[model samples]
Target: MLRLSAQHLHELAQYAGDHGVRVVTENWFALLDRPAEVLHLLEALDGEVGLLLDFGNWTGERKYADLAQIARLAESTHAKANYDADGNLQTADYAHCLKICADAGFQGPHSLIFDSAGDEWTEIAKLRDFVLAAL
Candidate 1:
């Protein structure tokens, strides 16, 4: 599920691991200003826990944190297809985001967020390609 903050990622991760549920955290850019904290949490996570990392959500304040950082904290991701500037919808930088996850060696599907005329299928396809290319 796409959770709200990084504050409870580790706890949630551990819980998911224990319960045999695949966990994927969201709103990750909330902690981008303090990446060390994110790193610490990711490093401590059990492999079962992953992230639904999203580039669209990273827009507001931490727009510059880079993809490798995000990838390091993810196993899965939310392949968002829109960009917002001053709250206006625009095209997303999906290619670049894919590269980021690729560079970091993530090999999982990227769950899609609905946009335009697509379902999770289009996004999932892109995410799969990203995984194949990246790994």
Candidate 2:
């Protein structure tokens, strides 16, 4: 399955490139949940496609390390913010993720992601402020 996906992605990337469009994939798919798989796909593509790292995609104890492993390959990022029931930001984790990307020399654009139930603009502003401070 991974091989097949990689082949398809490579072809798609070629097609997109012909139209002057760059192809990028995120680490959100179940098939690409692991760092090795993501790396393999990128290797198969041979720089034809770039990665859009998502902060909230991979979870658990290895999340940070996993993200660090591929941070350098990212063309952009989905800076997804998590919040508690009380609406407090998960500062330590988020900041650490941002720091990892920054340390890896990731200078790409960060697309803020906030999905909590509230005024989206306000939540986005809060997230933006936190990201600014962290970076």
Candidate 3:
């Protein structure tokens, strides 16, 4: 199944490349969630596709380690943040994730991801500020 998925991604990436579009995958998918799986897929694709690492994905004890392993491969990132109803940032987790990416030399744009119930622009701005500070 992993091989099949990799093959399909390779084909899609090739097609997108032909039209000058870069193909990137996020860590949200279950099949590609593990560090080893992600590395395997990248190897199968010959590093042709870029990774858009999502900070919110891959929960559990090894989340940080898994993210650190793949951080250097990311061309871009989804800086997803969890917020309380009152709009308080979960500083530790977000900051740690940012640190992991930074330590891995991930020099890429962090596209903010916030879906808390509040004023959209305000929340986005808050997230952006937090990310900048953390980075």
| TM-score to true structure, per model | 0.58, 0.95, 0.93
The lDDT of each candidate is: 0.59, 0.92, 0.87
> 12-129, model 2: which lDDT tens digit per residue?
9989999999999998759899899999988988999899999999989999999999999999999998888898888998999899899999999999999888999998998888
Q: For candidate 1, write residues 48-67 as lDDT tens digits.
A: 45566676676644453545
Best by lDDT: 2
Off by over 4 Å in 1: 1-15, 27-34, 44-48, 60-64, 83-92, 115-135
Candidate rank order under TM-score: 2, 3, 1
Comparing 1 and 3 on lDDT, the stronger one: 3
Clashes (candidate 3)? 0
- Kindly list the per-residue Cα lDDT of model 3 for residues 1-135, writing each as its tens digit: 888988889999999999999999888657887998888888889978889999888888998999999999999999998766677888888998999999999888999998778788998998888887776
Q: Is candidate 1 or candidate 3 better by TM-score?
A: 3
Best by TM-score: 2
lDDT of 2 at 114: 90
As a whole number from 0 to 100, the lDDT of residue 97 in candidate 3 is 91
**Regions of candidate 2 where Cα sits further than 4 Å from its true position:** none
Q: What C-alpha lDDT, on a 0 to 100 scale, does residue 125 get in candidate 1? A: 73
Which residue pairs in candidate 3 collide? none
| RMSD after CA superposition, every candidate | 5.9, 1.0, 1.3
